[model samples]
Target: MKNEINIIIITPELSKEGGGGIAIYTQILAKELSLDFEVERVVTLKERAVVNRVRVLFLSIVKVFYLLNRKKRKIAHIHTAHDSSFFRKSIFVRLCKIFKTPVILHLHSPSFALSFKKKSEKQQENIRKVFKLADKVIVLSKREKEWYLDNIEKRPPLVVYNGMNDLISSSDKVSERRNTVLFLGQLGHRKGTYDLIKAFKKVLENYSDAKLTLAGDGEVDECQKLVKSLQMDNSVEFLGWIGLEKKRELLNSSKIFVLPSHQEAFPLTILEAMSTRLPIISTFVGGIPEAIENNISGLLINAGDIEALSRNILKLLNNTLLCDKIGEFARERYLTHFKLTQTTENIKKIYTELL
Candidate 1:
């Protein structure tokens, strides 16, 4: 065996709690990759790739020269960049070319452009330029790849569905009497936090005991205000930013997992809920459909459709057998496709080929 592939994982952030799914992916993937590769993670402290508030270009240039000066470095991978300054991109691209190293551009965002809003001309041009520089573009889902394929004239992307580490140890511990519907993920417009509240309000007509406990954080005050406005303050529990222990705790007690996201690239949260045998009710967006087979593993409703979201939630709540059946199916699907080991093997293949 070739002893180790010296690989560097460069990203803007690496905080476990603050960085969301990307950080989780980096942490887990790096640990797994360490088996075959000597992985070095270099994260910028701020949004700008800075070293003590200095530009990343300066330090990246220093790092690249150091690597090139030393021998046996196999790959220099850059993870997730958005709307970077021209100097950073030029310096990075030029350095990679000079060193003759493969640069893997891993894209975490569902959209190709930096801002989800209407893109400025400069932003559009810069995005295209960045795409051109990458040797390989690793997209998290097929839906995300579609945007780049249609818009950018660059090397096409590879779709690698986000993997889930088998952290749900208490799979047998089922909630016998579940009264709560759990929403675990970013609480924002794109995530459909508003729609979930509206649907939960509608659900209260018949299943008055049904309570919504939100896990994770984003626009927390706004989401809480909406719940209060709907007089769901009594019905909803805003458990903001639960840790791993608390996340598992919430998942165990909850009847159903709901994510009414308008845009998603693949959610690890859904897989986690599934592993714990909670039936899912999600919007038919992104890789969610790739995983959820619309009432098979879970129910998939149209994004922002409050009525359909409520209907699906109510269906699972009313039929205990249906909930159990769907939960079983969801767990089986996760085992088959989304397991950490399986995903790691697939990623290893990609790295091997690239190297």
Candidate 2:
């Protein structure tokens, strides 16, 4: 069966090192599918330099053309975000259509609706045309699927929440975790990093010993400036762009995980925190509400609400029993819905249907 079906996963960069959620998603999907199918990964954008990236993209197009020309039962699984990522993957979708091969457009963008609304009418139509070309469209959340159904195209997209392997062990104990709050992802305005910093400052008014750790790359200088301005330099630590092992260590040691993003389709970091049995405090945006029940598995606050963010953080920190309960419930939800095996199986069913 592995030799009979060929699955081609298209992404900007396939490496786990310094890759965003989309890259990580592609890597996991490709690895799992390879166990049962002949998997090929086509990296369309790898180089950091603009000229090199453009050259690589062109080469990827040629490579896709050549691969589809071969005699095989193949499916092109293209992972894309908004704006340039969408346009780049649309080329592959068109090429797959030309070869009469099934293509799946897997969207991982949180602000895709906003991006689409910013485009001109003709450009919006072009975007719709590209979406229509694909044999199937997969979204990260049901909310996203509905948005596409009402705005992008009438065909409803399949929802596939991002999943992760469980990261907690029996030896891991809540008593051993520190009073540390962890935020993992790009450090920019969209992610509400500055808001989190301000909220953390407020949190320090009560629990002065509480620490905030910001990991991942983006606007580090700006975020540092904000931290300094808020007099949180001593309390807030920024570790730019960490690897998987470091992320796991942070998840295990941190008492809480918070991501107050202005927008998100579905964040894999939330699932990672859940898998590690860490109480989460995130915004009520995108598919987050689907994953977290308010005051149950985790706490949810509106985006950019610094006061609410601070209050929620304190609510969990002030009560250890409540924090442990939320963390345990989060882990339960992860095991029931967002485990890596379950996600891979759902994706495999889509592939089978398309085939």
Candidate 3:
């Protein structure tokens, strides 16, 4: 076998507690990157038990020193987001620069652009400096790339859509799923759970059998209260952070998949929904539009528009032919453009080109 290309990845969270989008993305990405590159990953976020800030700082300095001291040539792949995350990863970025190591800042935050605006001019300059130091900057979608250009004067950032495995084949394109509209993400305002609830209220007027299953963690208590207040307890179900098998089971069983999130950076769950051949109803925010063609592969609506959301939900639920057509087209789109293999290959190419 060819001796692999050496690369070191530093991420804030590696364990399950830290298992947000970045954790899932890192696990799959490192695995794929390892096929052609020798990857050394560093998880900065400590376990449940932690000491004071001084101790954390000392430990971080020591870890960076150790990683930079390695004899082999490797790109420092820094995964960063907003606020404290930027500060922490900035340390690694500066260290890589000090050691003359090539750096690639893989930005994966939807709130990153907004956060940049919150910072002072000096702080924003420092953030831009961090971007400039990188040998290459990777953003999630075309929208994100534009945002970066607008904020930071640097080389055009690269766009890489997050990818997942496709579940349904062309032959298995038909969806026999129940009249359930599934929302698979964290439960909160940013995810549009409240709007989904309101929209489902409208949906109930037409098809009383329609069910909305939200399968993730976040603000669940508040969500429970909202459901009770709205008197939708029976129709809305919160599975509370399900495992992969349970998620797949729900995706397979559900007829419609809806993610009304007001913010995103090319969500992997939407791709997961597309893979399962579920007709999608998501907001037009972020890079979701890049993956979904409005009324073609999936229906896109304005964020917080409960009426429009419910209208699409009702449309798909009533028309079996339209639902199946969209679902089949979505799966076909996934196979054509958004497979995990394609993502891995594109990433591999980027690495080779950079070298």
Candidate 4:
């Protein structure tokens, strides 16, 4: 029997074509919650072009207003990022308030605190007002929750770590994987793509047969130029904007996963790597330290420290026993703390409380 409760999830596009972690999280939440609750997903920001986006956003607001006009009690779960995304979702939050419907603002921006500080004081006040209107606010990490409490709002936001289903299967074995280091995200300075390329040049000095695969879109030509300048054309391969199957294949085939991002809020890529039991090498920023205990589950270094990044890559490459141990621990951590079911249950509890 289906539950009587209704959940309307408003987010950006859910398709893999142009979606990121926010879209993936929204998809997972909708899928898992649909089994019990009456879940509906509304796509707001799908177009890349600005004029098109404005048109779509207006239509979405109209549609949501219609949906909320009904007499039934409903909840609005709005997923948003920084800058334009925040403003876009704020409209829906206001609509919820007009209808007296409960609204849950789920923030997904990795550098929200930094970006919020950079905004003008008036804009910052507007953001704070939006948060105050929401019935509840959900952050991706404890660090983010504290930032929101101190800066955005006086009320404490709930910290629900982004979670996903395990990608590795019983047949997959780490010993059978290749000597490949994989990076999955936008190929730009923010994700430290150039730094990873520079560090990989150092890794090639020790392991000539090792490979580096970069999978994602953004600044591809620039990254390729850097790779070529370092004389690493043969060692580095760029796969632009891959889908789920290709991501799974790369995770399964690769020996290590590296995402030396300058900023992050519990990246889904790290969780993806952890679930596959590939020892991770990432920078200590945002909520990374919470998930990855240094030298235990995975390795962590300060952002932009190319020497340390290279050293950690070599450390995992040289010691097979240590790599397996860290990978095993990472999998255990994922199962215990970051499972999709756990996130769904926590979210359900919040919904129950609000209803």
By lDDT, who's the top model here?
A: 4
Q: Can you write out model 4's per-residue Cα lDDT over 33-100, one digit (the tens) per residue?
A: 99998887888988788887988898899889888987767899999999989989999999999999
Candidate 2 collision pairs: none
Looking at model 2, which ten-residue stretch has the lowest summed lDDT? Answer: 167-176
Give the better candidate number (3 or 4) by TM-score: 4
Which is superior by lDDT, 2 or 4?
A: 4
The reply for model 1, stretches above 4 Å from the true place, is: 14-16, 45-69, 84-94, 113-117, 120-125, 173-177
Clashes of each: 0, 0, 0, 0
Candidate 1: C-alpha lDDT: 0.76
Question: Model 1, 107-211: lDDT tens per residue?
Answer: 776443536336777766766776687777788777777777877764678888778876565655333747799998879888999999999998999899999
Candidates 1 and 3 compared by lDDT, better number = 3
Instruction: Report, for every candidate in turn, its global Cα lDDT versus the true structure.
Output: 0.76, 0.89, 0.83, 0.90
RMSD in order of candidates = 3.1, 1.5, 2.2, 1.3
Cα deviation of 320, candidate 1, in Å: 1.1
TM-score, predicted candidate 3 vs. hidden true structure: 0.93
Could you give candidate 3's per-residue lDDT for residues 1-355 as a string of tens digits? 6445677877755335446788777877788778777887777664434564446656767876886898876688888888877888888888889999888889989799889999999999998988898888989999899989989975898888888876553344434668898998888999998899888888988888888898888889998898899888899988888777777788778889999988888899989889988899998988999999999999999999988988899889889899889988888888888999898887777777767
Model 2 collision count: 0
